[model samples]
Target: MGNILCDGSPIESDPRYRFQGRQWETSMMDAPCNNCKGCFLAMFCPCCFAYHLRVLALEGRMENYSCCQGYLCPTCTSKCIPGQDSCPEFCLCLEVTLCENFAISSTRFYIQDQRQIMTDPCDNRIIRFNNCVQILSFVCHILAIFFRELRHLAHLLDLFADLVYCMVQACMQAQTHHELTLHPTAVDYGQAPRTITQQPTASDKAPLMGHQAPPAYSE
Candidate 1:
């Protein structure tokens, strides 16, 4: 019992160092410089700064991180997407729009993406056309017939009225039919639309398209 107490004091201890048990020597390293809000916090790794920023972006706290909100360069300001450093100031991201439901009668706008929306009412033009068509159709059909039966034939007044009414009815049908043919979903494929130009001949020597030749060859 006496010998056991005297010699047992000599004991070994384990090291607290992380690299002590490892086969390879571990190197102590410094992080990269993270220019966050000009605080100049140098990071332990360049990879880590990006990781942190991405995490911040995903968490919807990009504004909280000064480094993320700060624009790195002009290119970043121009090209960055939403939730990114140098993102667009105000952005709109709409995947689709069915024009049939669009409405702009109210000043209020529905904001789904980063930007406010602009609406325009659909089918209103159809309503207007229907209203106009009803009035014109009634007058042209009824009044033209009445005029033919009541008015004298030698004067040819009734015939003229009938012709004019027929023209009006034909025009209404044609215009409405043309409007009905318009489909918003149909993509034009970038073809230059036909525009009527009251273009004078080259011999006429017009001044220009928009500018009027200020009363030339006049007193």
Candidate 2:
């Protein structure tokens, strides 16, 4: 009939409700304010939670909210980390001193000079980057030259191929003309021979035993 937890325990029946190391000694029915809800149930108002945390932060009372074992804003958090001690993680200002008001490091610490420390390794990233830039520059130069020369080379190649094709065509045409001509110009100019020949006359033939034949006809 009441609000139940995961283990089937009722909120009304649960005994221990601890907060801020203080125990809720009384029953829920007895303490009307036990479940007042929202910000009233919280340590401070939502807005005040932030404000108080900030105040604490400046005061340097907090190490962090986890040490408080609960959630607190940046203000109350700083308050929990006691002043004079350094918390490099949250210390915004690189100060040997502390203040709850400032957010960033306004103070300075003794940082060792790089010259005093060991020399740094040569960064290949910088070398590789420089080399890449140089390579790109060289490529760009080559492309520029290639673009200018490509058109001229193409034109020359086209002209050369055209010349070769024309020469080959001329040679082929000359050979064909020599082999297949109907008339041989300038060489065979004379007339062609006649088709028919004349026959000889009968009077022109002579007899072998001749003289006798003419006398018999007269008788």
lDDT of 2 by residue, 94-176 (tens): 22123311111100000001001111112112222323333443444445454765444444444444343233222222221
| Candidate 1 weakest ten by summed lDDT | 105-114
TM-score of 1: 0.17
User: Residues 1-219, candidate 1, lDDT per residue (tens digit)?
Assistant: 334222212112201111111110111111011212211211222223223322322243433322222222324533443433343212211100111011110000111000111111112222233334334444444454456553233224334533433332222222222221231111321332232223211122101001011111111
lDDT (0 to 1) per candidate: 0.23, 0.25
| Candidate 1: segments with Cα more than 4 A from true spot | 1-155, 184-219
TM-score of each: 0.17, 0.17
